[model samples]
Target chain A: MPEAPRTGELAPELSLPDLQGRATSIRDLRGRPVLVTFLRHAG
Target chain B: MKVRDRWDRWEEIGAAAVFVVFDDPDLIRRTMLTDLDVGALPFDVLVDRSRGTYTRWGLTRASWSTIWLDPNVYKTYARLLRSGARLRSAGTDVLQLGGDFVLGPDGRVVLSRPQQRDDRPPVGELLRAARGSVEGGG
Candidate 1:
């Protein structure tokens, strides 16, 4: 596993597809504080 | 439940809440529609089929013992079962762990909470951390 981004470090850019297959990136929400929660799995 | 409960507050604070799942989008959509009674989620739901996001975020895989032996896991399972949610054949990697992160407007991580068990960090704590980041501009 890669190192998790530490506080004060830039969040690694994430470009992933949403449920509707639309691509979304973390960089696009830069003007707002983003709370990103990673789930274990969809199940 | 935390995220869903505080959805409006998160938006009120000018924060976007995104959920990244390590599974295919179809499975996610199906599960959400069939098993959950909650209407559409208020925030974004991203699918990371390749688990690249997990690797990049340094999330570890839970050991078999960790999954089976944890009481919290059993409680959660029981609760879901009681709520009419049935266990299906696992389609994704069950061992993959999860975490929460609060990123500032500048794209820098403000808070990170890696799951130590089956549960996630409380939404209140996440909100507090986010509020602190916004107030302190740290």
Candidate 2:
């Protein structure tokens, strides 16, 4: 099946902390095309 | 099997940003530094220690029991639990969901792989889709 926030849906603006704990928001990448991968915890 | 080895293999087709969130931050950091197994995984490898992301996404351990409980699969934990006194007691099964989302410059999702079971993806396919998005096909 296809993923959520389907082809035409707008991605929710997420302001997550990077590895260094710096806040990075999705809106920050407003100009360049972005590829987002929601990954799982390595078990 | 060394999970990091597979990670090294995917590093070659660089373009799409790579990120890995691990349950154990200490273990991941130690293994990455000492073993140098995933030396070339160009992007940040972060921690999901509290499982905040898991719950937010509707991913649950119970949901994946069928996959891990299959008799044909050879999982170390399953085997170990089987030989114990409480052998048939079904153990906790964790489901790890992953996928790629191609977002346009406007922060809209154009393509996504919603049902992947693990973090690994076909490098060729991912790059192709990513390239297509960059070309405005998405």
Q: Per-model C-alpha lDDT, please?
A: 0.81, 0.50
Spell out the clash pairs found in candidate 2. none
Chain A TM-score vs. truth, each candidate: 0.87, 0.78
| Alpha-carbon DockQ of candidate 2 | 0.39
> Per-residue lDDT tens digits of candidate 1, residues B16-102?
888888777677767754655423666888888888887888878889899879998889889989999787766578888888999
Off by over 4 Å in 2: A1-3, B1-24, B31-41, B46-64, B70-93, B116-120
What interface RMSD does candidate 1 have? 1.8
Worst 10 contiguous positions by lDDT, candidate 1 chain B = B32-41
How far residue A26's Cα lies from its native spot in candidate 1, in Å, is: 0.6
Report residue B129 deviation for candidate 2 (angstroms). 1.5
Lowest summed lDDT across 10 adjacent residues in model 2 chain B is found at B85-94
- What is the C-alpha RMSD, rounded to one decimal, of candidate 2? 7.0
What class would a CAPRI assessor give candidate 2's docking?
A: acceptable
Can you give the TM-score per candidate against the true fold? 0.88, 0.60
Q: What is the TM-score of chain A in candidate 2?
A: 0.78
